[model samples]
Target: MVEESAPDRTTVATVTRNTASTITAKFQADNSEPVENKNTWGYVNVTEVTDALQDTAAHDVCAPFNAPVPNYRAPHRRTIQVKCYEYIWLIKYREQTILKNEACKRHRLNLPKDVNPPSGERYTYQGEFPHMGIIGWKDKEGDYIFMCAGSLISAKFVITAAHCTNLRDPSVEKPTPDIVRFGDRSIVPEAADAEFTVESKIHRIIIHPVPNYRELYRFRLTE
Candidate 1:
């Protein structure tokens, strides 16, 4: 009798621990076999599976289903270093040709051939200015409202007018922005052109402490 090659021990252990219930369920469902232990969790529990999947996903930075690079991962601390890391990572992974070029193009990393963009709304499309973003707040009626326009110069920071963060009328307090949407062009929610818009919540707001025109004028004259 010919003997079959034994499978790797680690692979076997991983498969047994990970997919035993899944395989058992499918097999039992098809073959009409009763679970040996009914009350001992025959099926995979949702929470257990979710937690396990999350743990595994956290380790794989390049996994397709994992969340995109967070704003905190902005390579601004050392621009040259980040650029080099990105370049090496792409080349080592054999993604240097198309994927590398696409990324560089999107971030305006490399020198681009001068092509005059058409003036106005006629020439623009969704995701053209990925840096451009919007700040949104929720009204008392539970409606998500657009508060102001901003630009995403880095991963974590958005640059917007100071007036948007402050109000002169004591009755009008600036509500914390509940939502921040990136790569969206249209003001109307229904008219959003971006299919994969990046979104985040405003955790903190930093406004400059510049004085009003009257105060500035007086201070300038006095100084």
Candidate 2:
């Protein structure tokens, strides 16, 4: 605690010491005649600091952690990199004829079922072959003429061989192919086709102009 009071020619309140007291102490420090000890009384204190080498804040601190750790695995190191490529040995493989995934296996096993039949053979149900289709047109005499077999892929389309139309009906002799028949397992002539039988109208038939495969001959067959 500091005392703030009127000085009796001495005391006062201040954070710094009095300059008069410092001057009085200096006067008493060397009371001998000024010229008598001139060689021992005064000398300049020399201090040289380069690049903060003499930083007084860390005077006695041993091994200060001021800088980041050095990275020995830095990219600038040249010999740390190595490159070599060796001959690879590949394992033998077996060719697969039919690849059946879980989805395909499930679809094959879980076909739609018909509990009761309206007509024809219910035991040998056509639901087992629901996607099968027969594409044909009626003749001019009203007699039905079957052309090519196809797969009823959707409610509106059937996929069939292009040769069925390309080579056979060259000049558009038949009527416009408007219907594709599916599930045509009619055991009796008078009975309805099948419980799953359906006929969908064809808007148009799109066939790829490119053949899937071509024969190559070098005096020997190779595939």
How high is each candidate's TM-score?
0.37, 0.33
| Per-residue lDDT value at 75 in model 1 | 20
Worst 10 contiguous positions by lDDT, candidate 1: 214-223
For 49-109, candidate 1 gives per-residue lDDT tens digits of 2333444344423223322222212322245434544444434333322333333233342
Residue 81: error of model 1 in Å?
41
Candidate 1: residue 3 lDDT (0-100) = 96
Runs in model 1 lying further than 4 Å from the true structure: 1-123, 167-174, 211-223
Q: Which residue pairs in candidate 2 have backbone atoms (N, alpha carbon, C) closer than 3 angstroms, thus clashing? A: none
Q: Which model scores highest in TM-score? A: 1
